[model samples]
Target: MNKISYIRWFNEIGIDDVPLVGGKNASLGEMYQNLTAEGVRVPNGFAVTAEAYCSVLEYNNAWQSLHAALDGLDPDNIRDLQARGEKARAIVYGCQLPDDLQVEILQGYAQLKREYGETISLAVRSSATAEDSPEASFAGQNDTYLNIASDDALLDGYKRCLASNFTDRSIHYKYDNHFDYYKVYISVVVMKMVRSDIGASGVMFSLDTETGFKDVVFINAAHGLGENVVQGTIDPDSFYAHKPSFVMGYRAVLKRRLGSKEKKMIFTNTLNTGNIAVEYTKNIDTSSEERSHYCITDSDVMVLTDYAIKVENHYSNKAGSYKPMDMEWAKDGLDGQLYMVQARPETVSSQKKGNILEIYHLKERSVVLLRGRAVGTKIGAGKARIINDVKHLKDFQPGEVLVADTTTPDWEPVMKIAAAIVTSRGGRTCHAAIVSRELGIPAIVGTENTNEVIKNGQAITISCAEGETGTVYDGLLGFEIQQTDLSQLGHPKTKIMMNLGNPDQAFSFASLPLDGIGLARMEFIINPTPRESPRFSHGEESGKLVLT
Candidate 1:
């Protein structure tokens, strides 16, 4: 196909044309043409194009041998997997580029230099067919070379990115996702990498992650590129931006921790902070210096929300549409303009009504001993286990009842499987209460001294929804039936559960019927650093539950 036709094809088909355009080239063409037309500002750059990528792949056919080898290999064998993946990468990188492709790549770089000028360096990023879809979000699954000084570097960077398609993490991700090995083709899109003033850029979701509310756009930004923010290397500032702009609620930034611009990670350093260091751990370039500007402002939010609505409206008009959207947007620091990065139909909209639960805005989950009457309701059947602290959480198996003194934020995994929770001391606002309400699990909390009564892995019962008079039954005591009493008067379908911290309270549910919990609290899923549980003062064993 002619160059213009290939570019046009990419704009129309996106990743669907990896065989013709390659991943990166297709994405660049799509972003440059379609996204730009839609008012998303992607820094100007040129794609060497996927047609070039396929020519190289076909020249070597390294993919065929790699595919055959991968077919028989067990995914559980990490050593063998890593070795094969490395070999595949070596084979791809070793292939010689055809003269025509090489000239095209250099010509593309020249075009970039011509368009964006020589004043700024370009970022050569990889875009593989299997990556960056709304379904998988294979972000950072491929290599991206930044600050390329010249054309030779760009060519070398492209080869390296092709090799990166076989990186251990990349391979594992593809294997787990069951991507078609033969069909997982890649294309490269070389872009004029933005010299961000904020040192780093990060993603903002147009909804609350915890509560799934569409009214708020959650922004997580850090001192450097979004990789650090998403990876949790440093605490990023979180902003709650209200949709369609609100005078006050539109911008609320939470500065958790600031990162050091000068203190970068070095493998040769004598001082070991034990943190995984990336090559970009060099001193912050002046290009990304933090500006005095607020990460987000009310005026900026109004502009972004307006753009978000426009994009949303435009996409809704597309055929085969189902529900509302969840989208990603990026902002150019210099222009201070918002850009639509991606758009996808919201998945939760298709789920059953039971799984459709409202998300909440929470500061954080905490550990607290509480009390409650156990209502006689059990949902899923499971064994029982009494856990005292975070370190012991894994000991409880899936489909087991967890009785704990108090749980911390680390116990999310165990809660996913636990039958129910029964605590000795907390109330409705406690961590146990909040989680139980969210997971649709049955729980009983605030039953004073209840932890002293339950044993680890012993059979027990809990009834969370019976309010104050719920009873616990040793065996499955009643029929499973969905209830709507927990939901508010207007929102009758809303489900509410219980959170608990103690095990002994299981006996409180020896009678009475109740519905399942909305969440199972697991605050201390796993404690990395051991800390003493909050202790009772002298003569405080019988202290009033409401100390405040």
Candidate 2:
């Protein structure tokens, strides 16, 4: 107990502790230790190390059996994968923590209780040691227990988080990333839960997620807990702020799009989840007035922009490179203050190769079936397969496009094979978008009504290359791929600075041999005053984008 190896306080750990505390906790520690004085409001917390999880399972003699259950897991074999994953999880969950670790865990919880009082509801989140990397972002591959109000619930939540390491998505992700299943570990982050259930919660990216444009901050916010937004269960209000112009004290607000926000996830006292009673969160329909208004104010957007840029700059400097960040934030209704909960590297756009340009031009334009937030620049044509329920996805073919309201980690198997993906809800950072980017496939999300309009087995062409507004053509439309290797092309004699507005074209513009960006317009000059979507046509002289 005196050695103190099982737990790490947020201030006591740094990014180097990822092996022990996992990426999420490590990043939280990094921000906590480094950025609080800078006004980045990160809630205080502690993390139960992976070593603790390993020791508990080993001490209980369940380690080998758990490994045995998942050994040789064939990710492609869905049924087998499920059976083995369940077995492995049960094995881990059944294991009891050793006396020493249990005492330490209680002591850790006591410290929080002393600070926040006895009934301090906590947020228990899982952080895999290998997650949040540019090559492999394990998006929602595990469980998150919110509003856990007691030590017993905390212990159970801890075990549940560890067990989630063997979830279907986690297993497939490990296999796909060529990770050693045995070596990968899960750390449990128990943080002071924000009362966003009374305020707002959401996720934000330091860069334009759709275009990999690093000069803008893209945010998706909802009325309650962040799970709804992160889970793609709700199409949250979207906001954009130009970082450079914002920093220069110019009118930084770029665009704001209102979502239907028909539902909001709120905290509940307790619920029985598979016989275990735990503090749970529930989703309920939003009022017409709540649906009509924005979750956070415009002034709040600017404040978030400041915090996001600071965090991104800090992480980017730590890595000695530009590491755009993916962060989660919440507004404490009691205090009416915004607090940053978590931050990690913005994986997809940051990791993409900006040296080459690949444009998809539809040779034959057809009736535009629908439009949405585009993910990736690729184009895909396939039979539209309406997957209303995940159970019906068994008949989904490799070359077909998956059409759904939303996609979860459980949908990865079908997602890997699909030529393209179309979802009626979710934004660029949602599950569908994250997975599609990883699978190197195109996806159109937040379409509103694709499931109603697009028929099953109908041939459709999905294009994300023209701009941010991804268009789904009625039929299989022939397209031309214009590949431009900037490395192969020579620079022009005169410096060619470009005028930019549409966020979509920024990625493509970066591939061109340019002197610099002349301007990055902060107003709605290029795009029509957007009401619900960011993907709009470009307008005049408006220009100002500082990529360099």
Report lDDT (Cα) of residue 484, candidate 2. 79
Residue 2 error for model 2, in Å? Answer: 6.1
TM-score of each predicted structure versus truth: 0.58, 0.91
User: Against the hidden true structure, what lDDT does model 1 obtain?
Assistant: 0.50
Q: Pick the candidate with the highest lDDT.
A: 2
lDDT of 1 by residue, 1-548 (tens): 65532122234545345455454454445455655665656566655555566678887776687776567765435566667777878878888877777777777677667777775566666666765444444555677666665666667778887777777556766666788655676677666656443333545545443334455454544443444433323323445555544535444432122322222111121222553212323433322444333344555445555544544454445434533444444455656565544444333322225432221122222222233433223333345687776556647787787776555334544664678876654332234543454455766655555557655555554544333333444554444454443233342354544443432222222111333322232322233122544333446555432221
For candidate 2, lDDT tens digit of each residue in 1-548? Answer: 46757999999998988899899999899999999999989999999998987787779888689768987778888888888988988988888878888788888888998998886889999989998776777779888998888778888888899889988878887888899877889899989989999899899999877667778898889998888788777788999998999999986988898887878889887657665564487889999999999999988899899999999999888899889889999998778999999898877777777577677777888999999988888899999989987667677889999999999998898899999999998877778987898778999999999888999999999999877678899999898888777788998899888988665475557657887764466543544444543334336523634221
